[model samples]
Target chain A: MNFVHTMETFVEGKKKILLILLAVFLIALPYMLNSQYLVTVAVKIGSYTLLALGLNVLTGYTGLVSLGHAGFVAIGAYTSSLCAVKLGMNFFASMILGMVVAGLAGVLLGLPTMRVTGTYLSIITLGFGEIIKMIAMNWSSVTNGTLGVKNIPRPSIFGYDLTIANNGLYYLMLVLVLITTLFCIAVVKSKTGRAFQAIRADELASTMMGINITSYKILSFVISACICALGGALYASLIGYIDPNTFNFDVSTLILSIVILGGMGTIRGMFVGAAILIAFPEVSRFLMEYRFVLYGVILVLMMRFRPQGIMGWKSTMPYRLSKNVKEQVEKMDKNAPLNLLNETKG
Target chain B: MAEKEVLLKVDNITKRFGGIVAVDHVSCTVRKGEVVSIIGPNGAGKTTVFNMLTGVYEVDEGEIIFNGNPIHNKDPKEIVAAGISRTFQNIRLFSDLRVIENVLIGAHIKTKYNFFQSVFRTKKFREEEDKKTAEAIQLLKSIGLDYRRDDYASNLPYGEQRKLEITRAIATGAQLILLDEPAAGMNPQESAELMEFINKLKDQGYTILMIEHDMSVVMNVSDRIYVIDHGKPIAEGLPEEIANNPKVIEAYLGGVQNDAEDQ
Candidate 1:
């Protein structure tokens, strides 16, 4: 057991160094790009990473497919924006409130998971996203309907405004992404994370093992919603405006696809998936025009070739190999029996 | 002979799926510290009985009293909380997790950390997690799986996977453990080792009720055996009694003949 601990941490230590380097690169990305347009793209990747990180916890780790994450993001954006505009609240505090509101909605959405799963779950979530969009469209007094919310205030620390003009918002987004990534890794290492994986592996076995699937399922949804809500709040503040159209079914699908492309149930995969998904279209005007077709093709190819995504394959961890390899190889030979019979006949 | 207190009582439970009655008015009891076996042919309602005991299926008609509480129709999690744990007949393990993680999940009911504590990794959380990890490792060592603790559960060979499932059940700290089929796919040597492990569990004062098709394991490990056919118990007695009972023999042979005719 002690040796196991040492070996496990040795592997974990390598991951830690890699994570630190990644964080450093993200923080310095704005300086490296030296262009506001690319910096904005990096910021978009950061927000997408946050969204994919949360969805990974729900869809990847818990194995509950949700197609309404953008609904939660909409709830977050509206809630935070309204809180700041109508009530004159702090930007950061309003974002927290947004997370809470969206989290409650997640609980309401997760209740159906007690009875429905898989494709049915996906359908329910799709309905939830549409319902949210409808509310955003009709609730004119609060949301201003399709006209949308504008001039959303950016967050500030010690009176320093974090806006795109100052390149501070990009840094803020990067830091949030870093925090979210760490939070996800922490969760995947905890007991609750283990229970979620257990449920994903075998729900009946997980229940028999004393895991309350209902509560864990709800908890996963709540955490996932909160993270998405935070991303939504940041998006509103970053763009200085948001409308119901931005938070649509396509956005949810995009977030989910990011989780899938990055690798389900892995933290690093979020970054890889988000970068490619966010950057690919921006780099190619033709891809941007045929984005839907490209998405369909990528998904079809992924399903056919690598359903586990880029980083989902199991790594070669250190384990003791069987010592009788030569003997096993001999036994595996199809002609070994024939040779033995021939010798006996001779 | 002194009579042992009943640890579990399942009385007249029936389960129906649409128009078919899977289990009908089945009744059985497992006494404390006893190794009891429920043997039946395929589709004899053995697994259904186990499912009802563990609260996997809501009983259509019956009462399951465990430690003096009527636990019939309780939520599976609540049933587990009341100190009952089970393994599936098909060896359902958390394949995505490491072997130790499967066992740690079994200790979920025993852990003290909540969501907040887990997220924060506070002092109390760390202490409790360390304690549970130590306990889980100890359980793996006892079950002879410590060597493969870090390997994914799915990576294990079939026999070891069965052993891991049982080990996970044991990790739950249940007073009464129900095994659906502990020796279904094992070779003779593995089955014999499993019989030894079951005996060791009995010596440790754990009450065990099992649903098994392996007659060798059923006859050797069970202090008492109950034979069920067509959703009802046909006979119940000592292993010797069950082995020689005319009704039990007829039911088994009749079941085989029915299977052949259906084929």
Candidate 2:
């Protein structure tokens, strides 16, 4: 235990250097590998990372376990693809539209379900995912029905087409992942984030503390849906085709598995989880269909033993104070009456 | 003392759970800058009264007036926004969060920044966040828990956890604080310290309404005392009066004459 503590501190001290090295490695990954297949795999990992991070906000931070996240993803992909193909909209505009539509759907789901919680809520979300798939299969005019939307043009900025071979999609995914990660961090560190966690901790106490639990819960849903939708928009363009089958119950479970396998409520855990899960099947192709059994066994063992995930351990370092707050605390400490401090200590 | 205004007036408030009357038409008034205690034996509906006052349980009948405003049946968040906050009997701290984070959560209403501002880290967001952080630290310092600000709330000793709960209530910017069983599990020495702490809060000009099982702490710190038995207010007076009241004794010790006759 003592040695582990020392090692944790040692890693903590070199955190900045490690982060920089990791950034360089990620940026140069495609060039170093010199393989289009590896680059596509990396893009897939990035896409899943975004989805997992979105679910983490709701499930991990806000304690709202959702099993219907793929519904939002389907909404985004279909909306974006339909707009681009039918209306000839720009990629960015359609992506934003997709996110907005999915967010509205989230509000629709969040409102009536505000009063329900626990297993009941998860069941509702699971049904919601199925409802969305049914709609996609039946809504022939707009969604193209079971035939699916095809010929999704590659997203391009300034006439530079983004394709897997050219590594444009990979870079785009990287940027989105970075932005999403930062957004999650900002929300987690703010007062809004605190209220979400407070509700997770104790709902009655959170209400007494003047947190509007209903509004916060709804806000959490909107944010999670938006991020997931953004990933779906990218996924449609990357694959150049999307169908209801692409976002079935299995996809939702896959996204949820990444969150659980990496660590719930953690940002970095999403990356590690997505990498391992997305790469595992490819590496174990020789095992064929039996690999899925191994996957199920691994998850069961994970639940039995390290349920918090590989990176879910709470930090041992002191809580980080922002710069201005630290300065103010020091100033207050200097001006505090010595006798008063001593009295409290006694 | 005669001119002291009523900070809270709970009048004829009754709560029913199915066939049971949890709190029956109970009423009490707390004056400004006073430490008022509600004392009762076990299952006397003390916590139910607290829950009703804090809006955790809606009153089946009657009114709760805070500073001349009718507040009963309002949402708990609105009640807190009207400047009332409370500690829980079981000490509900955000155990996974740091101590200061728990306090910051208490200040959630006062944070004032919108979701977009927080996401973008706007000037208003930064200013409000820094101000709240510094204020939370100062509150911890006042209670001598400044050094433990970075520690998870669950890591604190029981006594300190109790103190942190009160501090979190104050961080809500509440003028009237409700403490539910603030000294429930404290030892004699800890209760004595809590007595002093309640007195200190009184000196700081905050109105406190507390339900305490520790008679010593209640009797020592309360400016006035209200006693109830079986969900009804049986007596209310000065602590000395309550101590000497025959009805109060009967309620506590349970009919001495009846016991003698049975013997």
Candidate 3:
């Protein structure tokens, strides 16, 4: 057990250093690469990572298999775009509003549909994604219908416009991604994280242990929705356009695939999952029309062989590999009234 | 036994399975610091009564008051919070987890640390964790499995699993521990150990309510016995007194006593 702890921390240390190196490389990446096409793909992949990270929280950690993440993303994109286009709110603030709206939607959806488990849950989510897409397509009053919100303004931070091809947006996105990643890692390591796993393991047992299963499960959905929403907000801003097609069911499927393929319930796994899911299609663009086919084949192979996903929670941990460690993954549940009362007042 | 200072009181408890009554109009009391056993033949609703008392099933028509607080029909979490926890007939464990981890989870209700604190293991959290670990390890040692702390619970063979189940219930900080058919799968020697373990818990000030089919185990460990036939308790008294009761013999063997024992 002590060895396990040591290994986890060591791996985390290595990962921290690697992340630093990756950030540095990204900062210098556009300069080194002559192809503007490659730089553009890199940015898209970066944005997709956030979506995958968010979806991973729902699918992997909390074990609430959602296929409606794209719906949340669409909600985010429209909310932020509408805020910028009509409400005249600043870009970052609009994105925050977008996330809040998405989170609230998650809570509402989670309340009614949380009873859906396993395959039933998947079907419901699938239907939900379609419904959301239909609404986005038909709702002209708020969304401008299928014509979509075009001429979306660039996000200007401190009156500095985030112009395309390596600008302040790159650093902003990277910094936010890093922060969100850290937040995710923290959440997964906490007590609620354990309760989420315990519910996944056995809802009956978890409930018997005094864990408020419903709260934690809904919390997972809200967090996941917020993250996906943030991704959408950024995506629309970066592209400076929006359409019902921009938030398609394919994006949701892609996000789900990244979480599953990366390793369900792993914070670090999201990075790996997101990278593969986002980059795979763009990387295989040379195959032109067959790119999606190649992507499907890759996904099929991954599911068949490594169903646990690339960076599964255990594998991605800064620790030694143990057999079926998920079975022993701890249970952290309940509220601390003492801590709450002790907290300093504003 | 109004004057008996009841520690637990069940008033008109009934449990029905669709159309059949499993526990019918059953009400009983467990006095403080007493060792009580619910003994009956197979499917006599003894375990059902235990389940109801432990808050596993909602009572059809009764109130369960523990330490004078009404606890019937509450969620199992609330029941546990009210200081009642149990061991299953067949051990239900997070089998793949380490022995220490299993107990740690059982002790989850008492850990005051927040989620963030547990992850970062803030000094306060670490202190609390160390205290919990020490307490859990102490319990493991008490049950003679401290050395197996790191081993997977499922790897401990049959008897140890039973022991682990008891230790887990104990770890819950429960004042009242319900043991359902705890000695069902154990050999004579293991049963003897469990008998001693029961006494040890009693000595530590836990009130035990156990269900047992093994007559010798019940006779040896229980200070009192409640013998149920069908869904109703036909007799409740000291084990020796219940053993000699005419109704108990008929319930166990149907009318005539066997061989020379009858005379």
Best by lDDT: 2
Per-residue lDDT over A85-121 for candidate 1, one digit per residue giving the tens place of the 0 to 100 score:
7887888899999999999999999999889988999
- Flag regions of model 3 displaced more than 4 Å: A1-35, A113-116, A313-346, B1-5, B54-56, B95-104, B113-165, B183-196, B214-220, B241-256, B259-263
Mark the regions of model 2 whose C-alpha exceeds 4 Å error after superposition: A1-8, A333-346, B257-263
TM-score of 3: 0.83
Compose the digit string of candidate 3's lDDT tens values, residues A1-346. Answer: 4665677778677988877887788787777764667666666777888998898878876678888789999988999999999888998899999999999988877775447678887787787778888998998998899999988888887888875554566666777788788778767654566566667766666666666777778888888889888989988988888889988878888888888888887776777877777778777878999998888898899889888887652332322212223222333222212111112111
Weakest 10 consecutive residues of candidate 3 chain B by summed lDDT: B254-263
Scored by lDDT, model 2 comes in at: 0.88
DockQ for all candidate structures vs. native: 0.23, 0.50, 0.28
Report the candidate with higher TM-score, 1 versus 2. 2
Candidate 1 displacement at residue A218 in angstroms: 1.2
Q: What tens digits encode model 3's per-residue C-alpha lDDT throughout B126-160?
A: 56666566556656665677667777777897888
Off by over 4 Å in 1: A1-20, A286-296, A315-346, B16-21, B255-263
Q: Write the per-residue lDDT of candidate 1 for residues B1-263, one digit (tens) a residue.
A: 79999989888899998998889888888899899999988899888888888888899997999999999999888888887888888889988778878888988888877877877878887777766666566566655677787788889998899888877887777888888898988899989989998887787677899989899999999989988888878999999988777778777785554454442
- What is each predicted model's overall lDDT from 0 to 1? 0.84, 0.88, 0.77
Candidates in order, interface RMSD in Å: 15.3, 5.1, 10.8
The pairs that clash in candidate 2 are none
